[model samples]
Target chain A: MIRLHRCCIALLMASAPVAASAASPIELTARVLVEQRQAAADGTTRIVLVPPARVTPGDAIVYTLIYRNTGSQPVPDLVVASPVPGNLLYAGPAEKAAVPEVSVDGKAFAPLAQLRVDGRPAIAADVRALRWRIAAPLTGGAAGQVAFRAIVK
Target chain B: MMNRILSPVALLAGTGAGLLIAPQALAQQVRSGTAAGVSISNQATVSYSVGGSSLTTSSNTATFVVDKKINLAVAELGGTPTIVARGATDQVTTFTVTNLTNATQDFRLEADQQDVSIPLLGTDDFNVTSVRVFVDSNGNGTYEAGVDRATFIDELAPDATVTVFIVANIPDVAGITQANVSLNAIAANSGQAGTLGGDVVATPLTTPDSPTTVDIVFADDTGLLDQPRNGQQRAFDAYRLGSAVVTLRKSARVLSDPVNGLASPHAIPGAVVEYCITVNNAGPNVANGITVTDALPANTDYISNSLTVGGIGTGDTCVLNGSIEDDDAVGADESDPYGGSFDGATVRATLPSVTPLVPLNVGFRVTIR
Candidate 1:
C-alpha cells in the first residue's frame, strides 16, 4: 500500500536542512610524545620549528610559543625567524606582538614592510596563510600568539 | 537557458521563487526485491454483538438501536502503506499524517499529542521540525479512550486551541490558509469554566490549513576595505607637488590587442577594487624621462594584450585601476616643484590574472636618459 504524503514540499523552499555538525570517528591514531619536541636557541627567547607538521594540505599550524629572554640587556634588532614549512601550502599574513619580518627559504629576508593587526584579523598574505614575523624587538618575558593560514594545495 | 541556469536578475535584483514551494514528492522510484510468493485473500466480515439496545421482535420503528458494545473488528489484510519524506530542501520542516487504523485513530507523537480537540487541532501532521502533542492525566503514554482521558484546550468549546507555527521563512511566505489548521496556541478556560487540562487530538472538524509567510535571510560580511601599506609607493606620489596622479585609466580605455585574445571590457557590476601606490624618482640631474606604472587585477583578463608608457623620466606617480564607468581621474589637480609638471603622465598595464603568492608584477620603469 502506498500512502500519498503531501508533507514534503519545495526543494528550494523547503525547511532549512539542519546543519549536521555530528562528528564520527573516521580514523584515529596517536603519536608518541617524544616525536614532537622542538629545541630553541640558547639565550634567545624564541623556538623554531625544525620539522613542521602538516595538519592538513592547506592548514597553517599556529604554534603557541613560550619564550623567556634569559639575558639582561634588552635585545634591539630582536628578530624571531621561523621559516615557512617547505612542504605545506603557502602561508598568508602573520600576526606579531613584538615585531614582524618574513622570509621564503631560511636565508634571504624581507622586512615585513606592512605589519598590522586588524581590529579584527591579524595579517593578510598572498598565500592562504602559515607563518608570520613579529617585526618588533622583544624586551623580556613577553609572549603572544601569531596566526596565519596555509593556502590549500 | 534562463531558467536552466539561475535567473541572474532575480539573483542580483529581486528575490525570485518566494519561500513558497510545492510539495517536493518527486521520486525516481528505484526498487529492488525478490518475489516472495504472492498471496490473495478476500475481505472477511466481523460480526460483533450489540448489547446496548435490544431489537424488539416486533418493533414499530425501522431504526436500528445503537449500543455500547465493544466493536472488536479484526479484519486482516496484507500490505502496509509506506510514506517516504519527499522534499529534500533545507528550508522548512514537513511531517506526515497517516490514518492507519480502520476507525481512523487520530495519532500524534508523544510530544505533539494534545489534551483537547475542541479549541485547536492536535499535531497529527508534521509541518515543522519537531512534533508536539497533549495528554492531561497520564502523560506517560496511555492513549486508549477513557483509560487516561487526554485533556487539551478545545477551540470549538472555546477553551482549548491548536496552532502549528511555521517558524521558518516567515518574511518570505505571504498567503496562509486556515483550511485544516490544528492550533498550537490558545487561551482557554478563561474564568475557570473548564478543567485544567486534556489530551489534544489532531483531527479536522473542518478542512486542513497551513501557514503563510516564510522568512529568508542571507549571510554577509561586516568590515570595510583597509590596507597596510608595503614599501612599494605609487608613481603619483613622486609626481605630487601638493597632490597628483597617473592617468593609467586611459590605457584601460585605449590599449591595442595583445598576442593573447582581447580581454573583456572592465565594466563588471561588482568587480572594482580601490588601490593606492607610491613611487619615488631617483635623480642624477632632473631625470626627464620619469614614468610610473600600474597593473590591473589578475582576475580581469586583459582586453588589449599589454600596456606601455610613451615617456616616463620626470617624476614618481600613483595609478588607479577600476571599472570603465567610473569617472575618478588619477591626477585631477596638483602642483610639482620637485620635478617637471605633467598631469596624466603615468604608465598602465593589465596583468593576465590575479596570482596569489606568485607576485604578478605591475610597476612602472624609468628610461634613465
Candidate 2:
C-alpha cells in the first residue's frame, strides 16, 4: 500500500508541466572584467581580459551581458537593458556590433547626440542606462553577448 | 564608432544615489576618490516576445569590492623659513600631514636634517640640537610647547589634515645662518582611536586577489626625496638665524667755562665737558642688557649727580632727556629704570633693550682741572 501511494505521488508530479512552462525562454548573465597588458614571446604587448581582483578609482572596467535562447522556439524582439551603477562612470560601448541607446533620466532614450543633462548636452559620463536591441531573431540554443566599458568613480 | 573616455572632473564631481554632499566634503572625497569596502554591483535584464507573450529575465549581479588606496601628503605650513634667534631652544618649524587614503590611517613621522639648500634661503650650514617631532593633540593649528606632545599621528581620517611640528635647538655657531630639515610621514594601519598603529607597506603585486579581503594599494605621488607608491611623503623647511649687529659711537662736547661764560665754550679749567656714547642696533634682532663704561679724562673731576642714560642722540651731541642719577651705584636711583653713576674715576651706565630702529644714548659730564 505504501509503494502504491509513492507511485501515485510520482505520477502527479510528472504530469505538472503548466507551471514550469510559464518560465522565460531566454537566459541572461552579466560579468565584470579588467584588462591586463602582457609581454608576448614575440617581443610585443598583448592585452587580455580577466576578472578583476580589486577595483579602485580611475580603473577602467568592462561589463559584459550574454543572452541564450533555451526554449524550443525562436525568441524575437530581444532587447537587453543594463543600468550603470552609481559608483561607475559609463566610458563607452565596448562592442561595435550594435549601437546602444542611452537614457539619462531612465525615461527618454535616444542616440548620444539627442540626450541632454541639466539643460546641457549629455556626455558619456551622464548615462544612467543603456539598451541594445538585436536586429535578428535569436534561434533556439543560440547565444549572443554585448559589452560596455565603465570607469570606477 | 564614437568613443569617449571619462574625465577626472566628472569622476570627482558627485556620486551615490540621492546623496547630497557639501562643497567641502566633496572636495575631500576628490582627494581620496571612492571609499574602501564599497560594493559596486551591476545586473542586466533581457526581455523578449514568444508567440504573442512577453517574458523577462534578469542576470546574476556582478559585484566587486573597492580596495584601500594608501596615500598621504606632507607640506610645509609657511612659505618662508622660521626665524630663530641664536641660542634659542625649542624653536618649531610647522608642517601639515593630510591623509589622502580611502580609509582612516595612522601616520609615523620622522624629522631629519639635510644639507640641501632650502627654497628662498641659503644652504644649510649648521646643525640643530635636540631635534624632535610632535603632533597637534587638540586639533589646533598652532604648536603648543607642552600641550601638543603626541609624537605620531593617531587615527587620522580620510581627507583630514593635522598639524605637525619639528622642534629643535639653535646653536650659537659663527658664520652659520640657515639649517634645513624635512618632515616625512608614512601611512600606517589605524588601530585604536587614541593609539598609533604599525607602519603599512606596499602590497606586493604577486599576491592573489581575495574577494572577501580588502587589498592595499600605494597611490601616493612623488614627494621631496621620496619615491612614488611608497605610501609616504616628505616636505622640507629651514631655520634662519636672527642676530643683532650693534654699533657704538662716542663723542665729547664742551658745555661751559668760567672764563668764557656761555658764549664760547672751551676745554679750559673749570669747564664742564659732556661725553656721549650712542649704541645702535642695525640687524634684524634686538639687543638687550647693554652697559656702557667710560673712564674720565686725565686731570678731570667727575661731576656728581650728572650721569644719565637712555637719552636720544643727535648728530654729534647727546640730548639730556634722561633721568638723573647719583654719584653712587648702590642706590635705588641707579636702576629705577635707566640710569648711570660715577665711582671716583670711571662712569657706568645701564640702558634698556636697543632695537633696530632706535638708538640708546649714555651721557655724563666731567669738570676739567
Candidate 3:
C-alpha cells in the first residue's frame, strides 16, 4: 500500500510543468565598506577596508555581493545584478574570476567597451548597474563573492 | 430847611420809582478786552419824576479780564550723537515737546529726513519706519514697548513735557557716513500751519474764556504761526560699518603601504589620502552665511562615509582627542556645528554665522582609483 501511494504522488508531480516545479537554490547578500589607513605593530602604515558608520562627499566605498548554493544539486548559469546607489558615482569593479558587464539604465547590458550614452561611448561615470555571469557551475555548499568601488557624490 | 428836606425826599422817592418802574429801561454797557490786562468795565444809570420834581441815580461799575493763551516748544533732549549701523532696525532719536501755554493743548508730531547732503560721503536720506509720540508713563525717559503709550499729546497740560521717539530703519548703502533726521511738533488746531498757534491771530471770540481761542493765537519763539518751533530740532547721527576679511587654506596627505616597512608612503593606486581645509575670519564684525566647498581630486574615489570635522591645532595637525564629528553619525544627542553634504564630486559645508578670529577646520578622506 505505501509503494502505491509513493507512485501516485510521483505521477502527480510529473504532470506539473518542470519549470514551475523547480525552485531556486541560490542565496545572495550585499554589504558595503570604506577604506581606512591603519598603523601596524612594526610602525608601518597599511590600507584596510572597514565597515563605515558615516560617509562624506569624495569618500570611496566598496560594495560586495556574496552568493552561496544551498540546494542538493548543482546550480548552473548563475547571474548576479546590483544597482549602484544614487548618491555615489561608479568607479570600477574589483578583480574577479569573471569579467562583469555594465548597464546605463538597468535594462540592456553590454561589455564596458560597447556601452554608450547619448550615442557616445559610456565612461565609468555613466554606469548605473553591474552584472556578473559565472562560467563555472556552483555546487551545493559552494560560495563566491564579487565587489565594485564607488565614490560619494 | 423845608425845601432841602423836600428835595432829598424827592430824590430818594425818584430813585426808588426808577428802580421799580424802569428797571428794564436802564442800559447796562460792557467793553471787550484780553487777558493781557486790556481794561473792561460796565456802567448803568436811571431817571424818574416824583411830584413834578426830576431826579437821577448812578449804579456801580463792573470789570472783567480774559485769560486765554496757548504755547508749545520742541527741543532735542540731548545733543549727544547717535551711532547706527547699515541694515539696522529700530534706530531711534528722542526729543521732548513741552506745552508752555497756560491752557491745555494737543500737539501733532511729524518726522522727516532732511535734505542735508554729505557730498564727500554720499546721500544721507533715510525714511523713518514709524514716528511715535509717547508720554513717559514711567518717567524713565526711555521708550519701552508695552510700558510707553503710543499716542499724540492730547490735552497736554501747561508746563508738561512728552517724549517723542522717531524710529527708522537704516538702509544698506555704502559711503553713508552720517544721517540727519528732523522732528517737528505743531498744535493740533494750527490751521494747517507748520508752527504752533502762538504766532497766528487768535480765533474770533465767540464765548469768553474758551481754550480753543488760545490755540489760534499762540506763536512760537520764531514768531511763526502754526509752524515747528526750535527750527525742526534736527538730530545728527553717525554711521559706521565694520570691515570683514576671511581666509581659507587647504592641505592633503597620502598614505600607502611600501614594499619595505620602513619606507615612507607613496601616492600609488589604492592609496588613501586625507585632506584638511581651514577657514579663518579676521574681522571686527561677524561673518554671516559662510560656506566651504572642495572638489574631489581626479582619478580618486571618495571613501564612502569618511567625511569628518574636528577642531585642529594652530598648524595643520589633526588632533585625535578633539571631538571628531562625522557627517553620517548624527544621532539624537549629537549636533553638527556646520551643515555638510556631498554632490558626487564636491563636498560643501555651510556655517550660518561665524565670529572673527575663530578658525574652522573640515577634513575628509579619499582613495586613489
Candidate 4:
C-alpha cells in the first residue's frame, strides 16, 4: 500500500504545470552629447546636438539614458542610476520625471530636499550621482528617456 | 808754672777728641742719604759776643726732587675681532688709552692699515675712507653718532683712561682674510688743543719743544736720570668681509588635464598653470628686502587673486598661504609673511626677510588664453 501511494504522488507532481523563468524586459542605453549654436541665414541662432569628443572649460554637456521594454510583459520597480563625472559639475536634471534622488558621495541617495553635504543642505553642484525611480510600470515595446546637464569645470 | 802746664795739656786733649768724633758723624750722614724717601740735615750754632752780650743763629736749607713723567698705553676694548662688510662705512673699533703719566697730558689719534700676507686671500691692503676718531662718551663700547664726542682728547688726567673710536669705511673688495687696522695714540705736549693734537715736542722740558717730543721726563726723589720720552700705544683689529650668496630656480606645471595625470602635463588652452619661484640664500648672512618677479608667459593671462607666497618647509611644501592683493594695494590680512602686487604683465612679490640656508617660494596661477 505505501509503494502504491508514493507512485500516485509522483504522478500527481509530474502532471502539475511547470512555471517558466522570466526574462529581463527593460533595455538601457547611455550617451553624452554637446550643444553647438549655428547662425541661420535669417540671422537667428539655432542649437545643434552633436556627440562630445573634447570640451573646453565653461562648456555645457548633456548625458542621456534611454530605456525600452524588450520583453512582452511589463517591468515594475525599475531603477536607473548614473554618476556625474568627477571633472564636470552637475547643473540640473535634463528632464522632468519623478523628481530624481541625488547623492553627494555616490553611496547614499535621498530626495533633493533631504540630501545633506557636510551637515548642510546640498546644492545641485554638490551632486555626484543621480537615480531615477519609475512610478508607472514600463509596458512592453514602450521606450522612456531621461537626461542631465553638466558643465566641464 | 804748674797751673799753666795743666791748663795747656787739658785743652790739647779736648780739641783732639772733638775732631775724631766729627769725622765719624760725617761718614754716618753720607750712608743714610743713599736710602730712598729719606731727608737729612745738619745744623751748627755759634755763640759770640762782639762787645758785651752773646748771640746765636742758624742757616735755612730745603731739598726736594721733582717728578715729570708721561706714559701712554693702549689696548683693544673687546677681545673678539670685528666683522666688516665691503663698502660699509663707520665700521668702528673701540680702544682704551690710559695715561700712565704723573701729569695731565693730551693724545693724538691716527689709524694706519697694516700689510697683511695671507696666501689665497686677496691682497691684505685696502683703502680706509672717511677715517674719524672720537671719544666714546657713554662708554658702552659701541659707537653712537650723536652720543660720542668727536674731539681731540685734551687734558687726560694722570692715571685716567678714555675710550676711543676709530671709524673707517671698508672698500668694496673680496677675499679679505685679515684686514688689519691699527689705532695709534701718541702723547702730546701740555696745552695742546686740536683734533690732531699739536706735534709732539722735541723735549718735554724744551722752552719751545720740537714738532714731535723725543722723550718723556721723569724726576723723582730717587734721583734716577733715565726716563722714556713721549710714548705711543697701538691697538689692532682684523676684519673679515663675508660674501652674500644667493641662488634662484623656477619651475612650471599645468595643474589641470595632465597628459598622464602623473607626469608631463600638456599645456592646453583654458587650463590652469602654476609657476613656482624658489629663492635660496646659502650665505652666512641674512638677506633683506628680497623681491621676486615673473612676467606672464605668452598666450596666457594672469588669474587675479590667485597669487600665493609661502616658505618652503622641510620637504618643499608650501606653508603660510599669504594674502594676495592688487599691485601696491593693502591686503586684507596683515599677518601674512609676504606681500604681492601686479605691475602691467609682471607679478612682483616682496619678502620681508630671508635667513641663511632657507628657501622661499613665490607661486601664482595663470590661465592659457
Candidate 5:
C-alpha cells in the first residue's frame, strides 16, 4: 500500500509542471482585511487592519492583490482587474496606482465621474469593477501589489 | 510554482438583477442593508504579455460572512399633545416603533413617566395614573379599547413599522394641566410566533469577528435619554387638560304680598317670594349640559309662568332676561335652548353652554299658603 501511494504521488508531481508551463508566469494572490477603530492611550483614534473574524454591515474592508513575474524575461502591459462584490460598495482605491479606471457595467471602463448609468453621472456606488494598468515593465523576479477599499453594504 | 484552480471569469451581479446597473431603482423600494449570514466573495484577475505571448491568471477567492446589525427606531406619532379631560380614563398617546435592522426581531415595550416639559407642550406638573404600554394588533393607526392588546411586538420584519400606545388615566386634581409619558422599545430574543420573547440585554461583544458565527452589533440611534448602540430607543408624548370649573349660588327674598302689593314685604304667609340661583364658570373650557333644580317649600305653591333663566346678575341681585317660562315641563319655552319650567313642586332650568367667566342666573316665584 505504501509503495502504491508513493507511486501515485510521484506521478502527480511529474504532471504538475506541465500544467504550470501552460498557465501564465505571473502569480497572483488576493486577501480581504477588515478595518477596525481603536481608542489609543493618547486620546486619539487609530484605525487597525486585521483579518476578518466578525464582519457586519457598514464595515470597511480592504482588498489587497499581490503579483509577481516568475518568468526569466521581462513582462509588459501588466493589468490587474477586480470586481466589487454585489454585497459591497467600492469606496475608493486604497493606494494610488497607474492609470486606474472604474466600470459601471463591467464592460465600459472610465473615470468615476466620466461614466454614466441610465443617462445619469455614475457615482462610486455604481462601480462594479476596477482596473489598473502598470506603466513600467515588470522585470523577472520582480513583485508588486495593489489594493482598494470597499464598504460592506 | 503551484497555482490553485479558479472559477470561470463571469462578473454577474448577485441576487437582484438591477443591483449593478440601477442601484437607485432598488433604493426606491424599502430595503435594509445586507442580511446576516450572507457570504461575500472577492477575486482578482491579472493579465500580461510574456516574451511577446499573452497570458492571464486569476487569484484565489477571499470570502467572509456578514454579521447581524441590531437597530431600531421609536417615534411619537402625533406632533401635538393629546387633549384629555380631568378624570379621563384610558386616554391614549400613540407612537411608532420601527425595526430598522436587517433581520426580523421582537421588541420589549416599556412605559415611563417624565417630569420635564415636552417640546411645544406645556410643563408636566402631574403624573398619569395606571400607565401601561400596548402594541397595535390591528394595523390601524388609532388605538382601540380592548382591541389592540398586544403588549410587546412579536417577530417584526425588517424595515417594518408598528404602532404602539401609552394608555393612562388623567388625575382629577386641580391645576394639573399637563402630563408627560414616554415609550421605550428594547431589542429582545425571537421565539415562537404570537409569544413574547425574553429580554435581549445587550452586552456588546468585546472580541473580533468569528467569520462563521453571527455576532450582534447595536446600531440604534440615540433616544431622549438612552445613548446610541444600547439596543433601546425612547420617545415622549404629553396629555393636556381641557376642563371647566363651575360654581353655583342660591338666594331668596320677598317680592310682594296679597295685602301689601308692590311695597316692602316680609316672608310671611301668602307672601310672594323669588329665589335666584347663579351658575358661574371659571374655566379654560366651556361647560356643557348644565341643569339646575330648585324645589318649592312645603305648604307653598309654585307661581305660574314665573320661571326665568340666563338672568344677568352678581351677588344677591338679579335681573330677569328674555321671555318668561311656563309651569309645564313640556312647551316651546323648554326648547328655547336657554329656558326653564316648573314641574309642580320643583323649578328646573337647563342651559346648553355656559361660557367661561360667564354667570347664568335661574329664577322662579312661589307663594306661601
Candidate 6:
C-alpha cells in the first residue's frame, strides 16, 4: 500500500495542467471505497449500523445493532444478508448468501431469526438475502437494523 | 331652569337620544376634528393611496376605509400591440375555424400551419381546443385566394417554424404502421384562460390557480412535430385597409393610477386604473376617406385614462380632443368574466389628430373614466 501510494504520487506529478481527468476521486490508497447511500424508506425509516464496518484477518468484529421506527407504521418480515467475506466463519448466528441448493461456492446461509408465520416456523431459505439484497425489507414507516460479523476461521 | 320644565315624554326621549350621542362623542375623543364631514349623501370618491392608510378625520367628516376597499392598480400590460394568433392550421386537406369564445377576438389565423392536431390515439381521444378561423363575413369557409385575408408571410416568410404538442403513451397511437398526424396552433387571445386552474395538476395543490390556461405559455420547440407542409395551399388573402380600416396600432405608457382584477365591475377606492387599449390595424390598407376608430367594452366603466397618438406622420403627434362616448349593448349577458356589466359601454377613438398622409400611431386613454 505504501509503495502504491508513492507510485500514485509519482504519476500525478508527471501529468500537470489536466486537472479533471485525473485519478479516481474515491480511491483510498488503492482500492476504491464504494459509497452505498441506501435509504430504508425516504429519509424517515433508516437503520445504518455498519454492523461490520471493519473486520480483522481472523477475528470477528461484533456490532451492537440499534434501529428505530421513526415513521408511524410498523416493519414486517425483513431479512439482512451479506456475502461472507473471505477467510472468515459466520459463527453459528448468521445468514449467508450461498447454499447446497443455491450456493455456487461452499458458502451457505443460515437465518439468525426463527420467526413463525401462520403458526409454522418459516423455512430458513426464505430469510436468506441474495447477491445484492439489502439489510432488510423495512416495513412501512418502520425502521429496523441488525448486527452481524464474520469470525476468522 | 328651562330643562326642569320638560314633559315626561320629552325626558324619556332625551334619555334615549343621549345614549346614542355618547358613541359619537366617545369616537371624537381622539382629539382634532377641525370641521370635516363624511357626506351622508351616499356619493363615494375612491382614490388609491399607496404610501399611507386610507383614513382621514375632521370635525364633521370622517373618511376611514380599510385597504381592502381600495382596488389594486396595475400598469397597462403589453407596450407595443402584438399580433395574437387565433386558430391556425396548416393541413393538406380542408380547414375550418369558427368563433369559439363567441366574440370578435382581435386575432388573425394563417392556414398552411404545416401542423395540425390529429388524434394519435383513438379519434375519440384527440380533442381540438380551438378552431377559430378568420373567415369572410359571407360565411364561406374557403379563402377567396386574394380578397379579405392578407398574406403577411408567404412560401418563404411564413417560415417561423414552431413545433410543440402533447404526446401521450396511450395504446391507440401505437397501433398505426403509418399515419398522418395533426396539431392546432392558436393565436394568443385576450380573455380568460381556456383551461381552468384545477386541470393543470392532476394532484391537489397547495395554492389556488390562474383563471386562464392559454396564458400558460409553452416555448416553441420545433423538434416535437416538424414535418414540412406536404404540399398544401397555405396562403392568406389580404384585407384592404378602408374607412373601416379599424387598425391604429398605438401603444405608449403615461404616468397613471393602478387597478387590478381589471375586468371587475366594481373598482377599489383610490385605485388608479392604468388603462391600456389598442385600436388595431384591421388591415386591408389605410384608405383615403378612412376614419380609424375604437369603442370601449361596457363591462368596465372608463375611470381616468387619457388617450394620445404620437408620431402620426414623419414626426407629427396628434390627440383625440373630445369626451369619450359609451355604447350600450341591447341584451348582452355578463355570466363570463369580460364584456362588462349588462349596461352601456364607453367608446374611444384612436385617429391621427391631423390626418394628411402616411401610417399613424394613434393612441388614447391615460385617464380613469
DockQ of predicted candidate 4: 0.00
- Which parts of model 4 have CA positions greater than 4 angstroms off? A1-153, B1-64, B117-128, B138-140, B172-178, B192-197, B202-215, B218-230, B242-369
Candidate 1 lDDT by residue in tens digits, B1-369: 223112222231221122112112111100101011111111101111123321111001111111111001111011111122222122221222211111111122222222222122211222323332333333332233343343332222211112211111111111211111122222111123334423222223252221111111111112111111110110000000111112222212212122222354233433322233333221111223333344444454322212222222122322332222111123321112111122234334322222111112222222111
Worst 10 residues of 2 chain B by lDDT: B1-10
Q: Count the backbone clashes (under 3 Å) in each candidate.
A: 107, 0, 24, 8, 3, 68
Model 6: per-residue lDDT, tens digit, B216-257? 111122323431221111221111112223434433333333
Winner by DockQ = 5
| CAPRI level of candidate 1 | incorrect
Tell me the TM-score for chain B of model 1: 0.15
Worst 10 residues of 5 chain A by lDDT: A14-23
Predicted structure with the largest TM-score when compared to the true one? 5
Task: Please give the CA lDDT of all the candidate structures.
Answer: 0.23, 0.79, 0.55, 0.59, 0.79, 0.26
Looking at model 1, what is the TM-score of chain A? Answer: 0.36
Computed on C-alphas against the true complex, the DockQ of each candidate is 0.00, 0.32, 0.00, 0.00, 0.40, 0.00
**True C-alpha contacts between chains kept, each model in order:** 0.00, 0.61, 0.00, 0.00, 0.64, 0.00
TM for candidate 4 is 0.35
User: Which residue segments of model 1 deviate by more than 4 Å?
Assistant: A1-54, A71-73, A94-99, A111-137, A144-147, B1-369
Regions of model 6 farther than 4 Å from truth: A1-153, B1-254, B258-268, B274-276, B279-285, B288-305, B310-345, B350-361, B366-369
Off by over 4 Å in 2: A1-22, A37-48, A95-99, B1-27, B118-121, B243-369
- Candidate 2 residue A117 Cα shift, in angstroms, is 3.1
- Please state the error at residue B65 of candidate 4 in Å: 3.6
- What lDDT score goes with residue A2 in model 4? 100
DockQ of 2: 0.32
